[model samples]
Target: MKTMILTTALLALTAGSVSAQQVVRLATEGAYPPFNFINDAGQVDGFEIALFNELCTRAEVSCEWVTTDWDGMIPNLQSGNFDAIVAGMSITDERREVIDFTQNYYPPAFSAYAAMDPDADIEGGVVAAQTNTIQAAHVAETGATLLEYATPDEAVGAVRNGEADAVFSDSDYLKPVVDESGGAFVWLGEPVQLGDGIGMGLRKSDTELKATFDTAIQSMKDDGSLNALLTEWFGGDDAPQF
Candidate 1:
């Protein structure tokens, strides 16, 4: 009886260890504001980080966050450096060929950033969202300039430095940039809609993790935790839903 009991305890301990060891490593473009921006002290702090922490708690899994460049995000995710991505990536069929995504988490809109000069023809028209974003189709359809930059900050910088006529991005993203730019740039108008909604990116093979995150996200939304976090970070609950 004693031996059997010891064996069962050992098995339980081993199982617990294995379960505790399970960690979902995530990659993000730590520069996108109100979503995954880095703070003044250079720590990760934003809506996505808060949401990720909440999901980690609900899923009862350990999570590790890492910063990656915007352009390199997909390739790094596909290469298996991380288990998933939650850096404001949009859900699109073209990206589906290479990876899977969770349910939409945030809405998208295209906002143009140009010099504060009102006379500038800042409208670059509808262009693609880099090469990998869902906005590729819109860019192709509209034949917009499709300005490309390595990072969100750099793209926004182009306008600040007078390098580009305007930088097009989601409205929430543009607001923070405008704030940081200190009036060097201004929003052209209400951000135009462009398949706006954010989603988590995961490898197709990690379908189980995707499902887990999806359920946890839904629960967070239902419980108002998601909205609360949005309000905490974005100053209101009217943030675009995913």
Candidate 2:
């Protein structure tokens, strides 16, 4: 009886280990371009997707990608709907209170104002920003008439339709829009640098998962793979260094 019990326990332990090595579910907001977006094939594709895949490979883990709206991301994470968030989520103290974050993969960048009119008043005019984002907070703090949208694209649309005087968001996101706007939209003022940087969000209880990703991130940084990926996505040679 004792020998049989020992064999059963060993088998159960092996099963548990196998389960822990299964695929990790990674979530992202598929609407954010360059960072993460739905490609023409109706699949999530972008810098974040590529980077996450590489990270998983380096860590010898498998991953499955899922798209979730920005508003529900943190809530879903907390409720165990997914394993980790690879969305373009910035690292801030407020967010850190709710969810733990891996080391920053992307450095904190500037937020710029884009408007149809060059002389639009950034401080007093109606400024559109994606709801629940750092840009929205910045607009409110600056005493601007803040118009919150569900998506970044909608914020830009508010400016185009004259509903808002300006749209404030990441320069990486807004720059491409302005360039393709045929001179219709122009940057209004200097960009504002906010937050620490972008990092993967994980449940506070998932310390092992976080450590796995953190090690992968550090490995990429040490080997220059992370910087190479940044330049590939953001363009130019200004990729941040560790």
Candidate 3:
């Protein structure tokens, strides 16, 4: 009986340790360009991917990345398929009810773009964002219809094709797009009223895991590994501040 009791105790201890070292799975919308996008090589690349790699290494946790649709990322996260979310998800109050977020990894800025046409008479100075993002909401307070797009690329495409006056999206994405467009379009260069910083999302039930992630993030920030990786992916001047 004593031997059986000791075995049970050992098993309990082992299980406890395993629980502490649980595998961490991360999810992202592989469609957000310059953030987390599917590259021509059909592999995930960009700012969030590089950042997640550094974070996992510093946290001493093994990680796996799963591609998820933007609309489904939060729902899937709530289902327990992943331990954390590294997607470029804005840390908003609506999301805070369901998940806790770590320190933001990028700043929040919006840029408006429109096709180059002298007669277009785009009245809004520097352009305005869509109506959905926090920036858009700010634009709305000013009574401007922040142009909305189904996707970031759609917004870019609108400007490229001259469909909807103009479209607004994250500035990081706009930079690459503007370069790729080869001067066909013009960026209005208006910084929208939005907060900088992207957060790591964790299930509200996993407060301990959130704490672990924050510590890892702070360590990376202090040691410069995070900055090095950012410079490699986003260029030194454009890297988002942690």
Candidate 4:
């Protein structure tokens, strides 16, 4: 009886250890504001970080956050540098060809143009956009001269430095810049809606993990918790309904 009990205890401990090892490493750009950004303390803190924590808890999975450069986010994910990406990545057919995404957590959002000159011509003037983003691709397809930067801040800086006529990016990310510009930067043109929405990215082989996050996302949507977070971060009625 004593021997049997000892063997059962050992098996239980081993099982618990295996379960504990099943942690998912979540990656984020940590540069996009209101979504994921490095705070004053130099720690990753934002809506996506908070949302990802909640989703991991609901999915019953352990998660560790990893910050990566925006341009290399997808490549690093494919190289197994991380388990998943929770950055402000939009769900698009072009991206879908390279990686699978969970159901969108945020609804489709619009991109806007910002420049020092309120009357800057968005169609024909030089524009700056972060490399490897939807805005960059859109700028390339337009009549504007596209200048690509490695980071969003760099793209914005181009406009401030007079290197580019305007900077085009996600409205949510650029709105705060315009607000804080103190009459220096202003909106240049009508905002354009792009992509489907923002979702977590995972490898094609990570179907089970994707399903776990998808279920958690759906739960948040059904309970209105996701909307609450969206409002808390984004503010106003612009948050899309689930």
Model 2, span 1-242: residue lDDT tens: 00100000011111221145466778888888999998887778899988987887777666778777888888888887778888899999999999999999998888899999999999898999999999998899987999999899999999989999999999999989999999999988788999999999999988877888899899999998998988898866654555
| lDDT assessment of candidate 3 | 0.63
Sort every candidate by lDDT, greatest first.
4, 2, 1, 3
Please write out the lDDT profile of model 1 over residues 90-123, one tens digit for every residue: 7766777888888776655454434455555544
Better of 1 and 4 by lDDT: 4
By lDDT, who's the top model here? 4
Colliding pairs, model 1? 104-242, 105-242, 106-198, 106-242, 108-196, 108-197
The alpha-carbon lDDT assigned to residue 231 of candidate 4 equals 87
Error of 4 at 48 (Å): 0.1
Q: In candidate 2, which residue ranges exceed 4 Å CA deviation?
A: 1-20, 238-242
Give the 10-residue window scoring lowest on summed lDDT in candidate 3.
Answer: 1-10
lDDT of each: 0.65, 0.84, 0.63, 0.85
True-vs-predicted CA distance for residue 26, candidate 2, Å: 0.7
- Give candidate 3 regions above 4 Å deviation: 1-21, 108-115, 118-132, 135-142
Question: How many times do residue backbones clash in model 1?
Answer: 6
| Stretches of model 4 off by over 4 angstroms after superposition | 1-20
- Candidate 4: C-alpha RMSD to true structure equals 8.8
* All candidates: TM-score: 0.80, 0.91, 0.78, 0.90
Candidate 4's displacement at residue 174, Å, is 0.7
> Which of the predicted structures, 3 or 4, would earn the higher TM-score when compared with the native?
4
